[model samples]
Target: MKKMPHLSFWQIWNVSFGFLGIQMGFALQSANVSRILSNLGADLHALPLFWIAAPLMGLIVQPIVGSASDRTWNRLGRRSPYILGGAIIAALAMFLMPNASIVVSIMPVLLFGLLMFALMDGSFNITMQPFRALVADMTPEEQRNVGYSTQSFLINAGAVLGSILPFLLTNSLGIANTAPEGQVPASVIWSFYIGGSALLLSVIWTVVKTKEYPPEEYAAYKGLDVKAEIDPQYKGFFGFFRLLKITPKTMIQLAVVQFFSWFALYIMWVYTTPAVSQHVWGCEIGDSASQAAQDAGDWIGILFAGYSLFAAIFSVFMSKIATKIGRKTVYSIALLIGGIAYCSTFLFEGGEMMHVNLLFTQVDVPSSAVLWMFPMIGVGIAWAAVLAMPYAILSESLPADKMGVFMGIFNFTIAGPQILSGLVAGSVLRFFFGGEAIYMLVVAGVSMFLGAISVIFVKPSKSN
Candidate 1:
């Protein structure tokens, strides 16, 4: 068996460069989707239901794309074709989602927005699963940590830009942050446009720059029979279930951690805008139309950006840190810090004001909200680990030929939790917490702490 050659840093970077754009689109969706839905007249309690589209789409799309990509070998390469196709559709969805109000006569604006959201998320899943397989396929075991961390860095870097774009547009470029009732804001609309453009262009760069190893060569590197077909038991509709039964012990252990981590993430993405608005900006609950609510929404973008920035910086050293301390330790510690960060929001009072410098301009924002940035540092640390460590660990245990399909199956841990979260989070917020979004974040914190503990049980491959 020929060992997979070590790729140069630039080669690894090019392999995962598309993730920057994919994450940019994702960050935009995360930071602004609730705001858009609120403006489109989605009730606060129903936001979770609407958000189910994202994880639902991921739950369905990823494994299918993963399975198909495993069998695919084309001129554009196994993963790159799906990556490019998904990018195109994702960009189109980005363009259409914020403009759903424009199609109100064709369908209800809120419904249109939700459909677009589903489409965008589906496309994102299509692109993302393949990218994960690509990294695992191209990199040798020794380089997997570096490959995934680089991907994490790019993902967070893109997230920073995507998360902050609306704030930048509103404060720096003077785009209107608030819009007429039932319409998305100009700032958000423009941010989606820019994000879509970035997504398409970045994916193109990866498709153009990176070359996949041919089947024979790839089989040689991974010590597989070049002419061998996929195992019969791993085929057809029930095949995924069969594959699940035989999944690696490491993958199964990691699933528990993924569930809690992604559950907390789903809560953060769905509730953060409203949580910050009511908790730290003094906006009335369900007041999406108010100036205060709009201001809070815009500020949430900055807060999301702050966390992503911290995550990006942290990811730069994640591989080295994981190397020294062990991956599970790093994963556990990061989640613990993130759990504390989420719980800390309760301490801030919304009255104080602070002037922040942005793009060489000063803007006044709630000082209490600024304090959120400190917690975001911890959130960022956890996020860096969340994006990199599990995959790094799992890739070592996976069969080389099944990498794409298994990666897709692993996403069940991610999507399933978010799906469960979406189903119950609204009810939890309303009944348990008296309609307070902030309390849901506390729930998220506890979930993260559980994830921290769960990571301790995962035994990595001996190579690690």
Candidate 2:
């Protein structure tokens, strides 16, 4: 068997560079979707139900894309074709998502927004799953951690820009941050436009710059018989289930950690705007059209950008830190810190003020709300690990030819918890917490703590 030759740093970068754009689109969605939905007349209690579209799309799309990409070999390459196709669809969806109000005469504003959301997220999953498999495909086992960490750094870099675009557009470019009832703010609408453009161009860069190994070479590198036929049992639609029956133990262990981590993340994405608005800015519940609520929404963007900035910085050190302390230890500590950070939002009174340095400009912001950045620092560290460590560990246990499908199957862990969270979060907010969105974050923190503990049970493959 021939050893897979090590790739240069630039080669690894090209393999994963599309992630920068994909995540930009994702960060834009995460930071602004709740605001958009609210502006389109979604009730506060129903926000979680609307968010179900994102994970449900991933649950359905990822496995199919993964399995199909496994068998697809074209002039564009095994994964690049899917990457390019998904980028086109996602960008189009982004352009249409915020304009739901413009087309309200054709369909209900909320329904149009929901359909676009589902399409955008489904395309994101299609692009993202391949990128994960591409890194594993291109890098040898020893370089897996570095490859995944580089991808994480890029993801956060794009997220930082995406998260801050609305705030910057409103405060620096003099765009309107508030709109009439049932319309998205002009700043947010423009941010989506810019983000969608970036998404297409970045994915094109990756598709043009990177090359996948041809079949005979790939089989040689993976130590497989070049002419051997794939197992008959692992074919077609039912094949995904057959593959699940023989799933790797490491994958099963990691699923528990993924569930809690993603559940917390879903809560954060869906509730953060309202949580900050009502809890820190003193807006009434369901006050999406008010000046205070709009300001709070913009501040939430800054808070999200702060966390992504910290996550990008932390990702640079993750490979080295995991090398010294082990991946499990690093994963556990990061999640523990994030859990503490999420719980800390309850300590602030809305009267404080702070000066934030962003993109070489200083902006004065509410002290109570800006103070949330302190907790974001912790969340950022966890975000870095969450993006890299589990995949680095799981990749070693997977068969090279099946990498795409297995990575897609792993999406179940991510999408399932999010689906469950979306189903229950609104009810939990209304009944258990008296419609106080801030407390939902505390529940997110508790979930992260559980994820931290679950990491201890994950046993890496002997090869690792």
Candidate 2 local lDDT, 295-397, one digit each (tens): 8999888889889999999999999999999999999999999999999988864876577777645766677886788999998998999999999999999
Off by over 4 Å in 1: 462-464
State in Å the error of residue 33, model 1.
0.2
> Which parts of model 2 have CA positions greater than 4 angstroms off?
353-364, 462-464
Best by TM-score: 1
Q: Estimate each model's TM-score.
A: 0.98, 0.98
1-464, model 1: which lDDT tens digit per residue? 99789999999999999999999999999999999999999999999999999989988999899999989999999999999999999999999999999998998999999999999999999999999999999999889889999999999999999998998888888999999999999999999999999999999999999999999999899888989988888899988899888788899899999999999999999999999999988888788999889889988888888899999999999999988988889999999999999988878758778788776457887889878888899889999999999999999888888888889999999999999999999999988988889998889999999999999899986321
Report RMSD for candidate 2. Answer: 1.4
Spell out the clash pairs found in candidate 1. Answer: none
TM-score of structure candidate 2: 0.98
Please report, as a residue range, the 10-residue window in candidate 1 with the lowest summed lDDT: 455-464
Q: Model 2 — which ten-residue stretch has the worst lDDT?
A: 352-361
